[model samples]
Structures are given as C-alpha cells and as structure tokens.
Target: MAKLFEPFTIKNITLKNRIVMSPMCMFAVEKEDGIVTPFHVTHYESRAIGGTGLVMVEATAIEPRGRIRPSDLGIWSDDHIEGLKTLTDRIHAHEAHAAIQLGHAGIKAQTNDIPIAPFSEEGTVTAMTPHMIDQMIDQFKVAAIRARKAGFDIIEIHAAHGYLLNQFLSPLTNKRSDAYGGTREHRYQVVKKVIDAVKAVFHGPLFVRISADEYHEAGNTAEDFIYFSQEMKAQGVDLIDVSTGGVVNVPINVFPGYQVAHAEMIKRGADIATGAVGLITEAAHAEEILNNQRADLIFIGRELLRHPYWPKVASEALNVELEAPTPYKRGWN
Candidate 1:
C-alpha cells in the first residue's frame, strides 16, 4: 500500500488515509444568513466520495459580522446546525471523517460591520475589550459544541490567515497594551483561552490552522509556531494544520511543499503531529513527505478543487489499489 493510503489516527478519530481535503472557502452560501447551501453539500460530498481520508470544511464564522466574505458559512446559532448536520452526514456516508474550521475574520472581515481586533483602529474597529474577548471565547466554545451536535469528527480553530485569532497572535497586528497584548505569553492568552474553552466543550480531536511564517521579519516564523504548538500540545490540541504567510498582505513565493518544511519543524520541535499544506499537488510529492515523516498528513487545496477524485486517481498513479464509489468500483483495495 502507498504511504498516502495509510491510516492516520489522532485521539479516537482515525482517517482512512493520509490525504486530507484542505478546507477552502467555497463562498457558496448565497443567503448570508449563515446557512449551508446545497452547493456546500455537493462541494464537500464530492471530496468525500473521491475517497479522501478526511474532509475539512471551510473557515466558518462564529458570528455573522466575523464573516470573511458575506457569503461565507457560519455556526453562530442553533439554526445553522441542521445544514451542518447534512454535510456531516454526507461525509460520513462516504466513509470520510468531517471537520469544520471555526473561525472569526476579525478586522479583515469584508462585511460592513466594523470588526473588533486586538488593537483599536480609528474610525473602524476597536481593540477587543476584556468583555468582548471573553464573549468571543464563549462563541468559539459554543461553535465547538454545535460542531459536535452536527456530527463532525473534528473541530479546527482558524488561528491563521490574519483572521481574528491570528490578528491577536501576530505582534504587528496586535498593539494592545493590556494583558491580552505586549508580551508573547500574553499574546497567547486569547488563543489559550479559546483552546481551553473548546476543549471544555469538544471531546473529539482538535486541530488548529496557523500561519507558521507571517513572511515579514517582525512577523511570526516556524520557530515561533514551534512554541505555539508546544503550548497547544500542552492544552490537548491533537494536530497543527500548518500553512504559511497570512498575517499581513504580502507576496509569498509559494511552491510545492514549501510549507511542508515548516510542518516538519513544528512536528519535530513540538513533538506533535502536523498536516502540511501549500502547493502540494502531486501524489509522489505527498507520498515522499509521508515516507520521510516530514509531516503527518498532506492537505491538498487547489488541486483538490480541480480534482475532487485526486485521492482515487492518486491511488492509481501510485499503483495502489483503492476503493472508489460503488458505481466505479473497478479497484476496491
């Protein structure tokens, strides 16, 4: 069997293979009411049917105003649970585990509502007050609980991509003088609180997506993420879905597996499992990473978008027989 087809287990949740469908926003939620549409159902189900081990849903907002795009999916209320349950059921029916990235866009939100952040911005948003900070933590906890109720197998914290959590984590974006700011330990306080809150409500495996390299010299780097990963590990985080350069708007010289090195660093340094993402398209490349233990899982994004059956096709490319959908069961290994 190919290494990519090997099962991976974190906590009690075990994936059928090492290939994970990286959560990419579909922007298919047209109603802007935080409900998952039929588009989302088909979009995610396609990947699961393609035989991915795990299918991570996109960055879903915990609050309406926290949406990155107006059409972005959300989990702010009980009303959103049913649509999410449909998605979970579709994924499970295809024998793939489901995960949803609980996220808040923060100051970067495209919506007209002013976003709250770690630092107050003039004529726009304000630095999060202690009360607001506590509320957001509870929101994350509630979102996690909702995810569990929706039948998701995992919950991912979107602490990456200049989002609310990353804005707090990045020193350049966070300029608060309070306890939620200043020192590195203090900057981590919000994330620590979010993690604790989620763990309190979520019993399944927890994952956090982080930009290991913020690209700027003053921004975060792989080494910094090593520390963050260690802290999350201590807090019972099961995996780090490693991505790079989303703190500030800057050009990134991206290439295949460019972020895999970062994942390897965090994995070895933090002694924790990690999922490598970024331009990792080819099966051989993904297999090599697994073969060398560079990362625990390979998160395929754009390629997965272009080829929903990438995993099934990859099995053929690697000459490892893998099961396909019932109608296409020529290879059922």
Candidate 2:
C-alpha cells in the first residue's frame, strides 16, 4: 500500500509526494488590479520549501468581476503573467510542482459590479446570456494559456464551493430552462466548455475541484458526482479533487476526514483519481486514506495554514525522509 509520502503520477507529470497544499485564498493582492503581490509569491514558496509535494495556488480569477474579493490574484490579462510566473518559479525552485486554480465567483463575487449567475435570486442582476457564457469560457481558456506561459505544472478548474460553475451545477441555484440548464447534463454545459477550453491550451495534468456533497437534501450528493466525475475525466481532467459543502449557506457537521468517503466514492464510482480535502490534519489519517486506496492524494487546508511546516512535521510522523531546504535543514531532526 502507498503511504502519505508516496508519489503520484499522471500524464507524464509526477508529484513527489501525496501531500498537496490545497488552494486557500489569502486576499493579499493589495494592488486591487487583480495582480498578485510579493506576499502571494512568498506565501506559496514557503509551503514548497516546507516539503509539500504540490503547491496549488489560491483561486485566481479569470475576469475582473469574477474575483471572490477585491484583493485576489488574477490571470484575466497578459499583464498578470510575469507576476504569476515569479510565483511558479519560486515553487519550482524548491522542487515542488506548482498549480493554479482558475475560477469565477459568479454571484458571490465581492465586487462593486453586480454579480451574475444562472438565475438571480437577489435584486436585479444579469443572468449570463448565451454570448456571456461563450465569453466566460473564452476567459477560462485564455487564463489557462497564460498559466501555461507562467510555467504552472497543472491547472485546476474550480467547479465547486458554490462558485460560478457550481452555481450552474446545482439545481438549487440553476433554474434556467435554456440549453444550459434544467437537467443535470444541461447544467454541466458550462463546465464542459470551460474544461474543453483549458484542455485546448494546457496539455499538462488537469484537475477539477468539486463539492461532492452539498449537505442540503435538495442539493447534490456524492452519488450524483460519480457521473460528474466521469464527465470531467472524459473532458481530460486527470484528477478530481473531492470536497463537500458551500453549495448552500448551511451549517454542516464537521469532523476529521469527514469528506474522505466522498473522495473514495468518486474514485471508485467514476474510475478516476481523486484527492480528499476537508479537516484532514493528521499525517496518519492522510496515510490511511492512501494506504486504503481511498484517495490518490490528500489536500490539507487550514492545517497547512496554521502550520506551514506541517508537511515537514508530517514526514517525520510518518517516518518518511523528506529533505528540507538547506537553510532550514538545521531545524530538521
């Protein structure tokens, strides 16, 4: 059985270990033009230097209005290229594969501009027109091309967490009667276009993050994602990063490794590689997920935030020898 430190490979790219630094928004792009600052560069490189096998950067907006916050990294234009390249270069310098999550915040966008969604439940807002949908897909494609130019090893499409793609995915929000809504397959139209667009430019390993369970009885379940995951795989997604909740603003019962089962189900049901995320803080527990063949990778979120050195410490706990940066080697046991 593979351990937490075991490597995972797909489509010619290999992650040195199973530990992935899940994308977490820092809202540190103080420039306000969707450009990342030095904080973003250092933020990701620290985890790379700390021995994380893969450092997935925070959700980077594909359009000015798609930003989750006023201050968030973006790849909407060519001007954002150099800054992102600097980030990936630093992570690669530490031998960690770098990835970027491309996303659109939709109605949840924290901007002055009125947000858009499949169907607006709030005050007057634009329901994305067919032309707007095409533009959005193009934006994702262009962002992906820019990420490849920035030297990202992987590109993860953020289709989960009630984001734009998620809005189109869930029946709770997507009540449209057009070709882009209603039935499950119809609702998946936008995501399929986004994935196809990304694949056109990015031949590298691709991943899609999805909320396997919406926690609302009327919302999607893990079983529903089995087919969605397969659809993602067919569109060239190399892996499914399984996460749950955020489709609705409901309180969910949180527990350690609570979402591991979702990842397991998607992996077995969709016949695709999957990554487990959500309150998974323990190295032993992460190893158990891999050893049991439940998940190909474990994405650590808040734990990695509270302790950037968690990967190094986790390596020790697992009796795995992970090399530290030369300057930090003295801190190693």
**For residues 241-266, could you state the per-residue lDDT of candidate 2 as single tens digits?**
99988888999888999999999999
C-alpha lDDT values of all predictions: 0.91, 0.90
Decoy 1 TM-score against native: 0.98
Could you give me the TM-score of model 2 versus the true structure? 0.97
Q: Which residue pairs does candidate 2 place in steric collision? A: none
The residue ranges of model 1 lying beyond 4 angstroms of the native Cα positions read 330-333
TM-scores of all predicted structures: 0.98, 0.97
Which residue pairs clash in candidate 1? 120-127
Question: In candidate 2, where is summed lDDT lowest over 10 consecutive residues?
Answer: 1-10
